[model samples]
Target: MPSSVTWGLLLLAGLCCLAPATLDEDAIQSASHKFMLNLADTAFSLYHQLVGPSNTTNIFFSPVSIATAFAMLSLGAEGTTRTELLEGLHLYWKEVPEAAIYTGLLNLLHTINEPDSEPWLITGNILFANLSVKFKDEFLKYVWELRHSDVFCLRFRDAKARSKVNDFIEMKIQEQDLDLFEEFDKDTTLVLVDYIVFEGLLEVKFEAETYVSEAFHVDKKTMKRIFMFRRSGQFELLHDEALSSWVLLQHYRGLGPTFLILPDAGKMQHLEAEVSQEHLTRIFHSMAARSASVYLPKVYISGTYDLKATLGGMGITKVFNDGAELSGISEGQPLKLSKALHEARLIIDEIVMDRSGARPSGKHRSNLLTVKFNRPFLVILMDKNFNIPLFLGKMVKPW
Candidate 1:
């Protein structure tokens, strides 16, 4: 039985939300690749800001989706309005041409979201606009070309409009718990909504017989009984000296690799502080295979973020302020982003699929190192192709 574990799950959904291929400036060439770098930059920054220095709330959301959705807005943004939005998203610092950023976003979306690929990660963008305003035909056309989304013109306060929006989201993600829109403001001319739902189904999952419903240590004194799934095999392992944590790498079927970092006792804060792109890449390259037993607590995380405050902290302000510039969306009226809402959830448990031969139930050997996530740890998840963070959070309790 393990005690008090504070874990952070950094899931970077590759709806193009994963980190870029490399953080090294020398490795960057085209703007398309730079798009990924920018995504990683924003992803890490946003996750850090949301979690703060001393906060440990389980946070989950997509940075790629946010950056891409706002990139669309940047198309219509003029002057400082556009500058602030791009800077906040970490999309402007590279001096990459604005058009190239849009192209990179479109390319990343297509790269991860091929028509023939499995739908492990599903995402969408929908614009709810006041019926009175008319978006220019060109803007709508480009949105379709860039975002693969459609716009709906309806009254902001209309209950039916909210229901329709929610209904569409539920249909896309197949999760009933998320699609909830209570009321739209009367002055709400445009509401950009983004949602992503990912269920990681690893190629190899722990069998039912091995699962133990045991008491877990949430802290020094609190104990809670939870289903701790156990597996034994050759897992890629890394002992990061700088962070004082052991990094475990696991693979998802069609998604990407997940890095679970178990910090030394009383080292969770130090690990959070030392998190960076360099450490991530170093771990990916340095982790080596080793025989060990791994224990994972079944986890489910969900949260909603007000992008206004989050992006504001990231240096993206004008769009949400009074003197905003969003006329590009619709010259039909003065447009400023009134609300940028996003939500996401992740569930990790035994997802049993049909198997052929005998499962890899390791032989009881004396040398087998046992790694129980019975204490505080961190989970860094990124989509396979995109290499960005899918879901990010710290959970003392996963419900």
Candidate 2:
């Protein structure tokens, strides 16, 4: 009943389990491989059900899940088989509504390798450089500015007011890239809107003013003020109460089309983890326009443990403060659950290393582990590299 003894027993069981795995032709059909197969089936099934078959909405799907799934399939299938499975997934990708998802999947596919009767480890580099050309072309553009303008308006009859108007026009021009936008004159009665872009088809709007929130500043006791100025340094009017403050600009630049002002690249990083429906819209729009790479990294680990006792003969202690329940189990529920728990622990601890390319593009990778637990539970998301969380609950709940 000591924890150390339990760990020793678990380690013995794991070694025994691994001993029978040979590289023979029938190796894949062994009982040890069932968990991986089930993982693949369940993961793809969940994705299919939740995401449907639309390329448009595909980018919104979790990048972690997509990359991990391919990595898992790569481990189990060979050259032709791997190609078939990858192509099969591509077939499904075509139905994705979100183009970024399509591109991102392609990025994921480039990370996997076919089994060669030896361990298949993917290096996570995308070989198809040309595959991104179209996406890139769609993102950047060139255009001619037919005319330029500046705000000559006056407020409170002060130089600062006049200066503010100038700053506004400059920021707007860069933010919106309008063919025609400027302040009329120093005596003009009109006030300028901060930063915004509006075309017949595309429109991006930002707050007229920035907030000086105590929480937002490094010095909580003080506030920070951010003013929207045109690229030319002209000032715009103020907006202090807006919830969202970033937008995009689109137009034609001579023979090629161009994207005007983009959301701050820093702000864009926040969008990567957002799973809302609206987040998908922005993600695809950016993907189509800029062809930016969204880098995602997933880590997992492996080890064996004994449920009843550790290798040092100490009794197993509950990992958390909450009391554990171990009433009745039909078979080896504790051992199986323990394995799942160990792998889960490895993932949460970031024990695995990320092996994607040097470029920060949305490249992702994962590690797999065979483990046994000192508790009872079911293994979820292992097939998908357990990138996504298995349960949904409070932000911080009982582990």
- Top candidate when judged by TM-score against the true structure: 1
Give the lDDT of residue 25 in candidate 2.
21
Please report the TM-score between candidate 2 and the true structure. Answer: 0.18
10 residues in a row with least lDDT, candidate 2: 138-147
Most accurate candidate by lDDT: 1
Off by over 4 Å in 2: 1-278, 286-334, 339-399
Give the per-residue lDDT digits (tens) of candidate 2, residues 1-399.
222122223332343343343212233223223322233332333333433233222111222333333322222223343333344333223322221222233333222222331222212211111111121111111000001112232342454543454444434434233222222333232221212111111122211122121111212243333321111111121111111212222221111111111122233223222223233234324433222211111112222112112211221233111222211111222210111010012222211222332323223212211111111111121112212222111100102
Q: Candidates' TM-scores?
A: 0.83, 0.18
State the weakest 10-residue window (summed lDDT) of model 1.
2-11
| Regions more than 4 Å wrong, model 1 | 1-29, 53-56, 159-161, 177-179, 207-209, 349-367
lDDT of 1 at 43: 81
